[model samples]
Target: MRALLVEDNDRLAGLLVTGLRRAGWTADVVDSLDAAIAACRTHQFDAVLLDRGLPDGDGLDMLRALRDAAPPPAILVLTARGGLPERVEGLNRGADDYLVKPVALEELVARLNAAVRRMRGGRRGPILVGRLEYDPISRAVTIGGVPFDPPPRERLLLEHLLQAMPRPLGKEALEERLDSFERGIGSNAVEVYVHRLRRRMEDMRAGVSIETVRGVGYRLRAVD
Candidate 1:
């Protein structure tokens, strides 16, 4: 999952980003409401963690704008304003959930997941391609009902491939999707991960295969 965290507090933002990444999420931080608006315009995010007080104006203003988005992202109001009235106002203004400051990392992640699930209108069944099965909500992948756990990045790569299906995902697109602002990765990073994941799939006798398209990228195809 990808998230946009609009927070001016550098320390808090760093901690939240680190925690979210550890939980298998990609997160980007923007300090002000204007930056958040711009970031949202340029990148697609699964969730947005917003703060009420910002350097420019109230975070609720952004929430108002986000409600107009074609497919608005799940918004969580994470601010120090813990009062009941503030919480009510946030929800009324289109926040999927309102969480106060000093929240637990685990709880925050859980709430974010819950909010997203709610926005998605509950969980959908696992994606099945040949013998490979992937549970989008749980981030679990299996083959023929057996457990399959790869390293985080490899798992994410596999998910992207599975989701895209017949359409090949370009190498540049994969690199951008896998890249996080906090990490400095090599230009050939996508190739490395694809190679590792492809080898693992082969070793497990996975029914699906990663087919490389020369001058293009890669696609997942079910073996006959």
Candidate 2:
């Protein structure tokens, strides 16, 4: 998935970008709040890793601005400020999740995934659709209680589709949701992922079908 990393510390920002990449995310690093706001306006990201302190202004303000937008990206605030009030204020201002400094990379990734999952209206954990269940945290999918393996990108694509089940999502819209702000994906990549995912579902006898809408895009329909 695509992400925005708003951090002023150059070293930490680099580390965060590399770590996010390893976790199947493309992240754009910005050191200032203005850049963060501009990036949010110009690009689409699945999530934003926001640091509360920035060079230009408070990251909380940026978070508030993002929340006020027509369609704000999911936000996970990263800060060294461990005060209870700060955490409470961040959540009250619409932050999806929060992580203090010195957090393990794995934990940060987990938090980001959870934030995105909730932003998509996913349940508390793995989402179940018909005979298939997908765990966003474990990055695992099971059909009929048997494990089904798919590539990471395909798994993420399936998660997105399953989250939007029964709703027809235009192809372009799907791409934007899957895209990270660091790199632009080709138009056909979404179709390619969907095609592969469809075959996998069929092979596993999963009672879920990805329906195509011709000029539109796709949707997941559960068959009981």
Candidate 3:
């Protein structure tokens, strides 16, 4: 999943970004409300980890703006203000979930997943397509109930394709979702991942195929 992390503290933001990447997330870090707003305008993030205190303004100020986004990303308010009224205010202001500071990475990720699941209509169970099964939370891939571990990039590509079944995901969209800003993404990067994943699925007889949509992009469909 892709996330926008709005935090001013350099050290904490770095740690969170590393932890999130380790947890299989592509995260973009911004330190101020202005930068966060700009990022929201630019990227299509699945969620936003918001810190209340910022150099320019209260982070909640941008909450309403973020809420206005089409298919708005799930918003989680992370702050040192743990007061009851503060938490209530944050939620009332359209935050999906609220977490006080000094949170464990595990707990943060769990809560973020829960929020995302709720946003996606509670699709928390394993996704089954033909003989292939994927557990979104665990990011585990299984074929005919046998565990299958692909390379990390391939795994991420499969997850995105599964989530976007039927509807083809454009190359640009796939590239944006799979990579972050710091890295220089190659033009054929998505194609490479797609090819690798397709080969693996075919070799495993997973009964699914990655179909190229010609001018569009790619879609995952069950084989006849």
Candidate 4:
């Protein structure tokens, strides 16, 4: 999953970004509310972790603006203010969840997972398509009950495609979800990964295929 971390504290932001990447999430850290807004406007993220206090402006205002924007991503507020009213206000402003400072990395990951799960309408865990099953928490994929070892980026690509199963996802949207602010991705990188994944799935005799839309994008479909 791709996430945006809107925290002004440089040290804390770095730590959180590292921890999130280790847990299979690509996180982009922005120190100011203005930068955060700009990031949200330009890119798409699976979730956003907004610190209530930013250097230039209130994080709550940023969150409200994000909620008002077109195609808003899920927002989770991270703050030191662990009071009743503060939490209430955050939620009222469209924060999906609130996390207090000095939070455990594991808990933050779990909460983020829960937020995404809730947003997906509480779908059953470990997405299944044909003979393949993908577990986001474990970051594992198994085909015909046998595990296939795919690199992290490949796995991330597969996860995104599976999440939007049966729907055609344009190349631009796929790239937006896969690229991080810190990483430089090639224009044809998505095609390369999709080709690799197709071969692997074929080797495993998985009853699915990644279909190209010819000038549009791709789709994951079950093959009879």
lDDT of 2 at 17: 88
Ranking by lDDT: 3, 1, 4, 2
Higher-scoring candidate on lDDT, 1 or 3: 3
Model 1: lowest-lDDT 10 consecutive positions: 176-185
Question: Relative to the true structure, how large is the alpha-carbon lDDT of every model?
Answer: 0.87, 0.82, 0.89, 0.85
Number of the predicted model whose lDDT against the real structure is largest: 3
Q: Which candidate ranks first by TM-score, i.e. highest? A: 3
Q: Estimate each model's TM-score.
A: 0.87, 0.78, 0.93, 0.88
lDDT of 1 by residue, 1-224 (tens): 77899999999999999899888888889999999998878777778999999999999989878877767889999999999999999999899999999899999999998887887789877888878899877777898888998876787689889878889999987876677666746889988998999788887888888889998899999896
In candidate 4 the C-alpha lDDT for residue 214 amounts to 89
lDDT of 2 by residue, 1-224 (tens): 67889999999998988898777776789899889889888777778888987878778887667887666788988999879999999898888988899999999998888887778677656778879997766667799999987875677677678767667888877777667655667879998989999898988889988888888788888876
> On TM-score, who's better, 3 or 4?
3
RMSD of each: 2.3, 3.3, 1.7, 2.3
Q: Estimate, for each residue in 24-68, the C-alpha lDDT of model 4 and write its tens digit.
A: 787899999889888888887778999977779778987767777
RMSD of 3: 1.7
Show the colliding residue pairs in model 3: none
Model 2 regions more than 4 Å off: 21-26, 83-97, 113-130, 135-139, 222-224
Off by over 4 Å in 1: 144-146, 213-216
- Model 1: how far is 137 from its true place, Å? 2.2
Q: Give RMSD (Å) of candidate 2 vs. truth.
A: 3.3
